[model samples]
Target chain A: MSAPSLFLTVESEGGAVCLRLAGVLDYDTSDELAARADACIEQGPRAGELHLDCEKLRLCDSTGLSALLMIHRRTTARGITLFLDNPPPFMERMLSVTGTRHLFAPESGKARQSCPDEVRETTD
Target chain B: MAPPPGIPVTRTGERQASGVWSTAPHPVLESAAGGVLTEVNPAASRLLRGARPGVRLADAAPAWLARADQDLRDRIVNGSGDTDGGASGWIGARSFEAHPSRSGNGNVVWWLVEDTDRRRAEEALATERERTAFLTEASHVLLSSLNTDRCVSATARLASEYLAEAAVVVSPARGGKLPLAHAVGGQDVVRSLVAADPSQLPGLDEALQGFPPVASRWIDPAALPAWMIPEGYTGTITSVVITPLPGQGVPAGALVLLRSGGQFTENEQIFARLFAARAGAALSAAHLYAEQSAITHTLMQDLLPPRLHRVNGVEFAGGYRPAAAQERVGGDFFDVHHAGSDGDDSSLVVLGDVCGKGLEAAVLTGKIRNTLQALVPMADDHQRMLGLLNGALLNSHHTRFATMVLASVRRTDHVVRLRLTSAGHPVPLVVRADGRVDEVGTHGTLIGALPDIESRTAETVLRPGETCLLYTDGFTEARGGPLGDEMFGEERLKRALSECADMPAEAVVERIQMLAAQWVRGGGHDDMAVVAITAPRTNHLSAVDGHTRGRYTA
Candidate 1:
């Protein structure tokens, strides 16, 4: 079988919505990503939780990442919790290199407790 | 005795006795007793313009010798011990030492002197030579390494050491950290050149604001960093000239050099400025190169896992291809994950395309894949996974989309659940164990179809000897296809899959890439991604012992 296309998946956890992404998220897909994240925030919690699933994600460009940044800003301002999780090695490194790792997936104690297990159970 | 190099050898007898120990290209004079010419070197003859050796030493030397020590005369004339007592002091004179020639005894009192006026001329010559050597080396260093920070730091260090001036390096940090590159100068003066707060030092502030490689001076320390005034310098700074350091883009930071003792001369300051300017360009280029490399490296690493995750029962063979040749690689990728505990032979294989390409698409791809990995365990079925993925993608961002084939293979029961969803993406090709070629087209639109949209699952069994191939549009859309332009279309991919039905995932990817590559001659028209898995349904087992069966589950 051929490999699948990139994906940006989102969900709800605790008081905020969750957004997860897989595959290649780039300029072409960033718009869709931006819309999804916005929907999560506009829907409830005055904020949302962004969980980026990088396991299957293969690539991302600056523009794709910028979308994530936009989502982060939106959610943070509205008191949403962004818990980007399971980032692929590549995504994690990029986030760290660009100094945005903390902004997206803050350490658990930094904000609200991350319900990783809970999110896992729900999403799975 | 041999003379030092460049001192020009001279014979003793040919030496001019008229002046006191004056000789050689650059000389250090040691006064002899009575200045009666107890000894003379030939260098003196050259200095005296070939004056005869028999000329009276005392009268032939500068008349100022009359005021010299009386003991000098006593030691030379009477051979008394006082040779070591001779002292040296500057005279109110410039170049070309002169002496009075008397018609008295050849035992004349001589004079010894060195014109301090020539010191500047000599120093300038030396400085010029050193600067040339330094800049040449700097050029080489700038071109060799692709590290921006190192290049900048190296250039600054070279400037500081070569020019013996305050060389400062500054770059804007992403956060609040006020990270200054570096500053090199005299311990006392360099501190003022480096101020933690811009407001604390007006001179430095002006220098930083002026442009890169710019130099500015504070005639008084009142406007500079506090420590610069510890002793309170007296000498007025001569000049502060800022030669803007060029950054590839916007200025990252500025180099502030403060000269407190002697204001830099016009030529010296110009040279310093030029060096800084060149260094800045080199640093910018190096930074760009480094950034590109880091991105490439990161992309490559991100494309593949550091180590394989062992999925029970089934062997995972997947490969990811990002357009490495492109300026920015695409986000196309694939991954094989342990959807269940290692204790079980249930694995989830996700082969798909992230909507779009380049960095953004890559990010979305990563999110979907990671989310699937976290959620697949609880997903229970391909449909549940699709739902979770859809939900996660919908929440991750706005308007992001993708196409994918998520399959759960259960090795224990030799069963597979395959689902294909396209958010405007091409469908995957499947090859049965018996070489039955089929395309699972349009199971649904690609991912990110809509926040609430759910894709139907494609129910298919991976019988023994069956292999499935998942990939992105870059495959069927391979360039060189002008409508009917010989594109490596779906037909070609299906044919290739049918041919390599038994090959492992990695091998299948390579084979297809090779075929496509040969067809394209050299380049990949678009980013191509592939995933292939072969599960031996019925065991051709030796029945020899206990071997774990491979299993995959969704």
Candidate 2:
């Protein structure tokens, strides 16, 4: 009857920061995501790219999408590039359907590392 | 004399009878058979005034003691043993118990023992128990209704019945006027609002301000205002106690008690305060609930979606279901704005879903709808209007974005012409007369996201018996089925739309909503909304009367 609870973990390797989101991101859990994103942005100047790893994300509703947009605004204001790393099938479809995939697309001349086969299938 | 019938002739008794009667602590009296006192000890002579030898018992002592003495003598003469217990009665201010015994001279000696302290204590305990029961019942009755006026009336009635002959419950002053509920013993409660000043009576102003009550002895009952007394209360006000009805944080009101007889004892005053405490809490809760519901009702009126109907000669219908059944408004919203009175036949129909659900999302939708309404003059240029809307949203502080579909519809002859555009929203689907469904190709980035937005508006036409369907993502994304996790998907919506060919505008909207609702099957969902625009089928025969839109024959 209720969605799976959301879990977020922050990991920094070398100069890049990765915020991994798991479980459900709906109306109830989207605010927490926004809060976590704000906290990460508060940490002083770091890497050029802030990656949101969505490999384990099961669902993202409209609210969750709004939270992602908020995070993009924060990262952009700080002169950091926000990236959608390892987006699952559903997440990729949501991004493309909402026409936000270009905002999080990989930079030019930087070959994306290990794009999911399902992403290629959907895009085709 | 054999110690007169049942009287014991013990050694101690004989000794007391011989000489100790003069120094006995309790009162002792000897009476003859005709109710005349023959002799009296020193204690008896001191206890009963006007008592001496040969005096009648009835003239010296209380009537109850004289009658008790006569009954005992009659029972003895009748050869029946005295089976009744000794009589107890108040003598002056103190209580006494009288036990009868026979002395050596064949006369009855009555011994009286004082038990005033014990009797007073028992009486106090019984009064306390009765007051406790009354307070418990008062709490139950006062809390039964959340109506503010009802709680006030109940408080007045309860105080009248238990505390005093009449009571008045004065609500907190507003605009120099106070609301009052007055109740009298064995009478119905009357409510009124009076402009009289509370400070007219001593301690009333302080009580209204939630201060501890001034003692009843300090307040003169003659100072009470005429409005404070209930009509038909014939008794003169002898004593009055004014106490504050303490509420959450502030005082709810004050209670005024009126009595025609004795002053309220310290204990009764304390008990009145206790009853006021319960009544105040109930009244405060009821007042808070009334205020909250009134505020919610006013706000919800603006956020609720309007019922769609035919606009500008084109049939328009809409259906919406919030994610939560208990909620009336949510993130999804739709509106149909008829063109200005400039003779233009086109109307702008807007449907959108804001991020999230419930009241927070509904607030955002309200902002978007207002912005769109202001931009209705630019309805001809869909791209320009969306660009302005997008700018407005980005300029604001909202962290959210919305996906919206806009359709400009106008009927020409038997066909409906439509200019459809999607702003990061689902494209409109057209259901043909023969049940063939087609998706209008329109695409754009969602509003309030990127500064430089791009959209492609598509033009289409609907023939008679054809309909255009616009919906939110909540339709295609609803997750429920035999598996309970599968998205309803665009393919399923298309298939469902294909079956609704040739149906009326309202019927088409209803069918789509029903199918999506069935798919969700009471599972968790997002806010779903749908709007249908159709060209009415021509019915020349029915149009002859011209009173109504002809019924569809299909």
Candidate 3:
């Protein structure tokens, strides 16, 4: 049998907490991350910022992407900031392809390359 | 420990009392020098049935005095004066502690205090603890496995370990016949228990109606099924507990626990019911997962690319690997469809990746696949077919788009012609016979985004040992490096492809995939696909060929 597919590590940096994700993020393991995100949202007042560290993330399926979107919605509703840091190229491609890249703020200047905020809309 | 509140001790530190001794609530028996009961108090008369004047103390309660010597009373009063913290023994069904008191004239009075209530309370506590431990063990075993068969076996093992000498789990088969999933302990005993149909047993049908577990009366081994009562089987089967595994709305299975002689306790029956409930819940979950996987598998089969068949001059091998954890078919797919009949070889091979991974992308993938399959007749003109596919994608209201590579492979004797087009996808690679690699720089606009799609077709010819590879971006976008943030990159892929010098088409594809999978190392990578078309290498090449004689020299 395959081992548990997702591993999450939470670290508090400055006033923000970063959830570093490793292994797979798919249908079976996405719910756990969603619950963790919800818990962070519940502590919104004290949790200055919510950041998902994708540096160690190996893969993210549509369900994993949807979970990120859900967390974005929750944080936005609670008037908190959410960041997606150092996403791999394929994950960036998925967000850009699906036209949902604006939901999360990327750390560093990585967002300036490949897919800029401009040229996002296509000519009819 | 001190004496009772009103008891007095003499200067010698021995317990001495006057009226308190005779009026004590505990039973008192006095024996003279001859070991005969000189007097029996009212409590003593009620405590021991044979307690009376002129009766021997040992005769009144033989179990209490069995270890007592004739001088036991004398030793308790004079030698130790305490009877070794009082001798404890059972008189009939009651437990008693005998304390001896001497009256200075060599007369010893024995005080019998009943201890049955304390012993019964301790036994009850011990039984409760055992039940809790068993329940915890059963829970761990039942919930550990998602497999239905394993869950069934776990249930039976738990029943045998805690509730019975032998246990069996019987589940209803699709037909009327019943199939046993798991059995523990004596196989013969389990077989004999199965001899009598449980449905015909009295009160069993009602018990299975979501009622409590019911116990069977002592069953004669001779009355069991012939197979159960083997030759020289002398062991007698006493009783069995039948507990139903309640399903969603109906009972899914039954648990049978066997015993040889002892009657089933009420607590044991309750534990059996709880265990059955856990088994039922786990079975229900396993069944649900199986049903869902079946549905997903059917959808996946429909979305998967067809196997590549042999075209006379070319050997084709293609594979699709989905990066989705549980669902194998995501957005990346490839297909090889032959448009020409028998010897006249003309085939259309297309590989594409929808924008995302999952159900939505999978749905889009199916749409693109079906459209390409329908356009095979007109596929001879690669540009026109792609134009039609682009128009079809633009017509959909959703913003979903895909990157694709379309190849038209034609064979004439020893030579094969290829025309390739790309819709904003990565350029295809060609592996030369002498271990050199060339990139076919094909360019195009993204399929669904543009109204008038501009795509350029790249043409190339392959010798006998040459091969062409077409794949999605998942190949180069896989992320794993020394720093762990770098992509696998096109340079690594090119180097890896060059290593498979003289391998066959299938072997070439497998080598590349194996390298990529190793690089990914089970990390999260995008869905990947590769299609290799190799011309079989003969002893000597046909220098004078009928087809186009163009070479791609990187």
Top-DockQ structure, candidate number: 2
Write candidate 3's Cα lDDT for B1-554 as tens digits: 22234533122212334234447677777777668876677788887888786888777866545245355755654766444445777787887777665555666667677788977787889987887887787777777777776777777767766777667676654454545643445232232223345455444445446565655544332344433223343446566677888877777677767667776776677778887887778776766776778888888889877777456557789887888768778888899888775546688889887766677788888989999999998887777887888788774233356778898888766656788888767788888888899998677755664456667889888777788889877888887766666788888999988877667789889998998888888687888899998776654443534233334334
- Cα lDDT of candidate 1 equals 0.56
What is the per-residue lDDT of model 2 for residues B1-554, given as tens digits with 9 covering 90 to 100? Answer: 01123433223334355355675667878888788987688888899988777999999999999999888888878979753447889999999988777765567778788889989999999998998899999999989998999999999999998899999999998798999999998368999989999999999999999999999999899998899989888898889999999998899999999998899988889999999999999999999988877875776799888998876567889999888876777889999987544766789999998887666776788899999999999899999999999888884344688999999988777789999999888889999999999999998889986787888999999998889999998899999988998989999999999988878899999999899889989898778899999887775445533225666555
Q: By DockQ, highest first, what's the ranking?
A: 2, 3, 1
lDDT per model, in order?
Answer: 0.56, 0.83, 0.70
Better structure of 1 and 2 per DockQ: 2
**Tens-digit lDDT string for candidate 3 (A9-96):** 6655344666767778876777788888787678663545787777667787655765776687677768888888888876887666
Worst 10-residue lDDT window, candidate 1 chain A: A115-124
Residue B217 of model 3, lDDT score:
47
lDDT of 1 by residue, B1-554 (tens): 12233532222323353233354343322233344343344545444432333444445444444345344556556876644343333333444332222223323322333555566587688888888877788888876777875676676566556664555555543454344544444232222233356546444444445443333443343355533322333444434344445666655455545455666666876787767667777877877787878886786566553232224544456554556565344666667665566555466666676645566666776687678778767645666666677776764435445666676666546545554443334556778766779866545534553444445556566665677777766676565643335667677778877887766555666787776666565555666777665665445342422144424333
Which parts of model 1 are misplaced by more than 4 Å? Answer: A1-124, B1-146, B153-263, B267-278, B281-310, B326-329, B341-344, B395-398, B413-425, B451-454, B481-485, B537-554
Give the winner by TM-score.
Answer: 2
| Lowest lDDT 10-residue stretch of candidate 3 chain A | A115-124
Instruction: Kindly indicate the candidate among 2 and 3 with the higher lDDT.
Output: 2
Model 2: per-residue Cα lDDT at residue B440: 96
After aligning candidate 3 to the native by TM-score, how far in Å is the CA of A21 from where it should be? Answer: 16
Docking class of 1: incorrect
